[model samples]
Target: LESILANLSAGVLVFDRRFVLRTVNEGALTILADDFSGLLGEAPENWPRQLALGEAIRGAFAEHESSEWQEQIELEHTDGLPQILLLRGTQLPAGSHGGYVVVFDDVTRLIAAQRSAAWGEVARRLAHEIKNPLTPIQLSAERLQMKLADRVSGSDAEMLSRSTQTIIRQVEAMKRMVNDFSDYARLPAPELTAVDLNALISEVLGLYETSRATIALKLAAKLPPVCGDATQLRQIIHNLLRNAEDAQESVDSPSIEIRTRLADNLAEMIVTDHGPGFPPEIMARVLEPYVTTKARGTGLGLAIVKKIVDEHQGRIRINNRQPAGGGVVSIALPLASLPTRGHRVSQLPTEA
Candidate 1:
């Protein structure tokens, strides 16, 4: 069973008396971005995880009553990319050479999604609380200026009026930022239903698409109707597509692709483009609200998409389309179960 699972695309590692790998699965090798060729017949401590994994494993073993250790530890690869893994191990019985079992399940995407969602929440709450008093304050300042215009001397009136105007301008700026927060937080819960995902993509493409950027659709046929909120899902699709458009503005050939498919009892939505993909530096933080590559972007777009998908009890994924080319990202939603709402008579986003 372990051997079969190891052959799968999830990483697995085994350690022996000297902390050398006795076995490693294909998935683990892929994640390491290296085959076990040079790593085989080496001490577990000597393996790629020598410093971090070795110390963690040794500590867990010594501290445990039994030879089992289970934890979520973060490891940074030589590429400087971080891999979050849930590490689990168990000691074989006596005479088993004190060997241990280990597994590494990558949770980088999960953690990114969580961080994005959290920041979005914080921004939303801040905006909601600030908006209430802002409107009245601005109104009162304006009214005071109007009433005092004729009562005060010209010199004093001019200074007081300018001060009030400055206050009003600053308050408006603060309101706008709060509005961004409100937008991030106010995506109402999705009301999911059975609907044609391809149609949804087509409708959204025709609606919010920009003449400034080329939009491509390569939707799959023979797929099952997706179970999700048409309106909210469309919003998600709209936001992601717009984001792709914004990313492509920097490329000479800006093209966007939208695709749909079903896999492992889940429905999938993939958006690809012929532009620069996510920045290598901030890929880990891109989903977090206020984390944007654009000079003027609010950076809450992806964060909103993530929250909507999570509300539907589905999963989403983002990746650079292989071949080291342009931008390519994906979103996946599980459709094994039926949704709980009626068809939505809805609309899409305006042109960007």
Candidate 2:
């Protein structure tokens, strides 16, 4: 019985009707980062203050009948970040000795994933609504200018031309923005194939050879292939390169470094650049759609990259490099040799 309770996935704790700790499983000790000996026979109010479970437990005992409640608790011991836990408390049946049982599970990652999916649905609906009218508006402006140019003369004709040009340009800009939203919202399943990472990176970089920025490549030899879609991978490379270029606009000398290597069971690709790093304020929410610092940016580039990476069952991290000044974007993908299912899977359209 003890061994079984020790291995349970969820943390379990039982307290007496008076709010004294009756029993705690090994799972609870591990989840709460506390010792079993310290919790036994102690009142909930006297439990370790750091755990912060005192108030919730006491309230449950105060109730006249069985009740249920849920809350999230953050623990600094796990890491420097908040770890979200889904806690459910149930009042045990009334009897000669009544108690309460509490169960909790770590659900931080699950909540984040759900939020991302919600954003993608929103992007798809927004694109559908905004993109439909842009083409007609642009064409109408073009036709109005061409047909009426000879009909009007002098300042009137000049004014008409400028107005139409502004309209066309603005409409074209809107089209680009809507297209980006569509891409983020409606990404198709990746067509999985064994792709040589080094070769793919070299090919993508070749497209920017004539640019003024200084670019460097450090391709590791004998690197393993990864399973992913070549087209989507190319887009990811392009977006990262373009972002690096834009980030360096305020700097005197711009340089970008693309590197590939094998790490443990994963194939890694890293893009680093000497430029103004991501602003501290938006760093946490960088992958969120429509969150941007650039004056003209649609802010969907990184979000789209994240969507594609998720489709491939890969991971990505972005952070400012230490000591030296710059930013790093690193991606880790499972090697092709690993046993994995094809990435081709459908996502049902989420309603707006």
Candidate 3:
């Protein structure tokens, strides 16, 4: 049992009465980029990973009388692989030989999630507080220009009017940028209706039908109604379809296929295209606001898609298409048990 537990994939350490290393698990050794035999007797200074682990063990020893010692700690190993360890255990009963058991867990992913969530909150605040004020400023500028036009006449007045108009125009542009950021920040609780998923797809498809890219809607026959915000949901689709259309720009035969299907409990919308695919490294951060790949791109399209999907309690995943068409984006939205939308998806005119 001792060997079995030690061999498990958890960084573990046992310390004797003096807090000296008595045993280290295979997991702990692996994290240190070494085997247990090599690390059994070495002090922390000799191993970077074990230094953090060793400190955690000591902290556990000091609080031995407590019910449990649990802390999430970060460690950097000589091998360059950073590992997160969860130090957790209780003190052995007072005996001739006292010791402690500690467990190390890799929480790198959890920490990343926490960081993403924190930064997302900061972005939201910046958008709302900073972006919200620009709209009023723009309106005020517009009103001031109107007054200036009426109050005076001449080249000087014309200059003032032009200046005011420029201010208004720039402010209006900034407002749109702010709106994009605000969209990235503020989340709307979806008012899910029994939306004909196919109908919504068609409406968005028809809206973009004028684009040079050949867009097709492959709706699942007898598709179930989806629960989502009709307007924002359309925004999500529009953004994706537009992205696909943009991707298809350099393709020999530009084409985008909006395919829907059931994958377990979620409704999947896959937008596949034929163009140069997304760069692998940028792919992960592609959904983040303002992370565009174009020569002059705002990069908010996918970010807005991500935000809306999140509001609708859906997932948006991106991947390259099979057999090399281009990129394939999958949006899996939770199937609503009860009606989550108050609006419905109505087909729009293809010409619009």
Candidate 4:
């Protein structure tokens, strides 16, 4: 029984009727990513809030009639991504030594997969529905402009031209938008190769030497190469840099920082901007398609970045920098030929 508990992926915790933790299996310790020394005799209330079972344990004890209860909770990690845990709590029989048993497993990937699928379907439908008529609309506007050019005179001719130009321009913009949707819906699988991430960032930075925002780089001297598609990786750098530039539009002394380092056998890149951080309400869903805080944003930039990262088996995290203010985006990719350790399969949830 002990060996089985030790090997199980689901976390298991046994608490006495008094709410003091009694027995915790190895699976529990691994899932919580915490040490057992502090958890053995601690009550739910005394457990670290980020790792605590919270109301699930207490609610199970209170609902005596029900044999089992289930809940989903989000655990916030100050230095890492938030974890979504699905927990099931069962009340011990009255005849047995009374207590509650809680079993939980990380379900963050499952939830993310569901969201990705839903959004992909939405993108496909939007592209198919909106893209079909864009060319006809643009061509019709151009035809009207040419046909009316000889008939109208003076200011009337100018008005006709302006109206037709406006129609053409707006139609072109819509076509681009629809193309973005199509790209997101059917992004190609990346062709894997060894990529020098730092070199790629440097190359992308060359295009921004005259950018309004001052860009700085702090690349590691001995960072290892990562396995990724060079072209897609370049797109990721471009998207992040553009985001940082847009974020600095309102700042008097706009500055952006890009840093790269090696950690946990992964090549990690961090991009920071000195702009107002993500709004509180939309931070959680910021990575979702068509969700944006920018007035002119298509909101597909980050979504595509996420899709590419997911394909490369990497992780991305977004957060607001505290005390100093601004926003930070971090991407971590596995080192070439090195398996990622202590990393989950999904992107980290945004932190605010």
Candidate 5:
């Protein structure tokens, strides 16, 4: 019984009729981050802040009736993001001392997956509905400008020309927006191949070396390769760099730094910029689709980067840099072993 309970995937805890914690499995310890031994004789009344759990157990023992309940609990740690747990409680059968058993599992990833799937479906429908009419509208406006420019005179023609130009420009902008939607909605599966992240970052940085922002690099010399789609990874890098550039546009000493290192069996890349940090109101939901603070953005840049990172089985975190006025974006990808010889790799990024 002890061996089986220790190996169980779901956390389990049992309370006596007196509401004292009688037993707990290893899963409980892992899930709740509590020492099971210490909780053996502890009463639920003293279980700080566990209002729902205490209420369910007390009701079951008081009414002598089996009860079932479910609730979400947040687990915060010092190293990573807070986890969300789905907890279920059930009243056990009557005995000399009746008790209730609780089982819980971490459902954070499940919720995120559902959200991602929903967004992908929405993106698909939006791109299909919005993109089809843009080209025709643009073409019509251009044709009108060419055919009617001389037909009108004075301010009429000037207004006509301006109107056509605005239509053309707006249509082009809409086309870009639709393209971004398509990219996020139809993100292809990453073609796994051994990729040197440092080299990849260097190649991406080469494209923006001429920009105003001072781009700096601090790549780990002995970093391991990561198995991922190079094309998608490049796009991720492009999005972050562009975001940093946009942020630094208004700063006096605009600067951006790209750094890489290995931590906890993962290859990590961090992008930091000297600019105003993310607004407090939107920082938590910055990755959600259609959430943006920029005037010209579709708000899907970070969302798409998140999608690609998720596809690569990686993690990303966005937070304000400490000591204060800049933003940091960090991503960690599982390191991959070098591929064997004769292994076929995919085409160049352009083809992808």
Candidate 6:
């Protein structure tokens, strides 16, 4: 039984009727992402509130007559990423001395996959529906402006010109929004190859030398190459840098830091800004499409970045920096095993 519990991916915890934790499996420790030394043999009330496990155990103890209780709870981790856990609790059979058993599994990735797919479908439909009329709208406004150019005089003429120009400009903005939707919906698969991550970052940073934000780099001396498409990877860097700059818009001396390191056979890159961190309301769903805090932001930048990183089989984490108020975005990609011949870098147009 112990071997089976140890090997199972689902976490299991046993507690007596008094609600003191008695047995916890290896899976529980890993899923919780913390040390349980002081938690063992402790009552639920005494356990940390952040774990949220205590609530599940208490509920089970309160309703021992019920068949089972199940719930999904979000746990904030030390690393800043919140984990979604599916927990189930049940009362142990009366014959074996009354106790309760709580079981849980990490379902963060599964939920994220579902949300991404749903948003992608929405983006596809929006692109198809909204993009068709944009060109005609812009053209009609231009035609009206030209035809009325000679008919109206003085202030009336100015009014006509202004109205038409406003129409044209708004149409152009809508067109841009539709394009973003299309890009998010139909992002291409990354062409995997052995490419130096540090080199690519340096190349992207060159474009931002004159940016309003003071950019700094702490790239590792000899970071290994990662398997990714150069063009798509460049987009990731561009988007992050743009976001960092936007975050520090109100600061007297805006600053951005970019760092790279190798860990656990993965190439990790981190971008941080010295600005007010993500607002509390939207931090959890910041990666979701159209969830943005910027007044002029389409909110698709991070969503598209998430999609690209997903295509490369990479991982991303967003959190606010401690002590100093700012935001941190971390991305980790699997290191390429072998070097590629004739590595190619593709240049593609970037959005503002």
Model 6, C-alpha of 308: deviation from truth (Å):
1.5
lDDT string, candidate 6, 1-352, tens digits = 9999999899999888776889989998898876688888998878874346686568655775647888788887656667898988888777788888889999988998999999999999999999898889889989998998999899999999999999999988888888989899999888877789999999998898799988889999889888888899999999998888898989999999999999876899999999998887798799999998889999999998999999888899888898888989999987776334334212211210
Candidate 4, which segments miss by more than 4 Å at Cα?
36-52, 60-64, 78-80, 133-171, 222-224, 278-283, 320-322, 335-352
lDDT of 1 by residue, 23-96 (tens): 88888777766666756778646656446766776677778846567888777765555778777778777686
Relative to the true structure, how large is the alpha-carbon lDDT of every model?
Answer: 0.74, 0.79, 0.71, 0.83, 0.81, 0.86
Error of 2 at 306 (Å): 1.1
lDDT of 4 by residue, 101-142 (tens): 889998878988899889999999988988888888889989
| Candidate 1, residue 225: lDDT | 73
List pairs with backbone clashes in candidate 1: 11-28, 19-44, 20-44
Per-residue error (Å), model 2, residue 105: 2.4
The TM-score measured for candidate 1 stands at 0.70
Indicate which candidate wins on TM-score: 6
Query: Which tens-of-lDDT digit does each residue in 213-299 have in candidate 5?
Result: 999999999898887889999999999999999988889889999999998867999999998877766774688788889887788
Specify the poorest-scoring 10-residue window by lDDT in model 5: 343-352
The estimated TM-scores of all candidates read 0.70, 0.73, 0.61, 0.78, 0.74, 0.83
Clashes of each: 3, 0, 6, 0, 0, 0
Question: Global lDDT for candidate 5?
Answer: 0.81
lDDT of 3 at 98: 66
List residue ranges in candidate 6 displaced over 4 A: 49-51, 60-65, 135-168, 338-352
Candidate 3 error regions (>4 Å): 1-116, 131-162, 322-325, 337-352
For residues 1-352, what per-residue lDDT tens digits would candidate 2 score against the true structure? 6777778988887777876788788777776666756668888767664445666556644653567877776454433234567777888777757778888887767876887989988888888999888889988999999999999999999999999999999988888877888888888888888889889999988889886679999988999788778899998899888889998998888999999999976789999999877776777568777888999888888988888888888898887776576878988886777534355222211210
Indicate the residue-level lDDT of 106 in model 4.
86
Q: What are the runs in model 2 whose C-alpha is more than 4 Å off? A: 1-5, 13-66, 72-82, 91-100, 142-162, 210-216, 251-255, 274-277, 322-325, 339-352
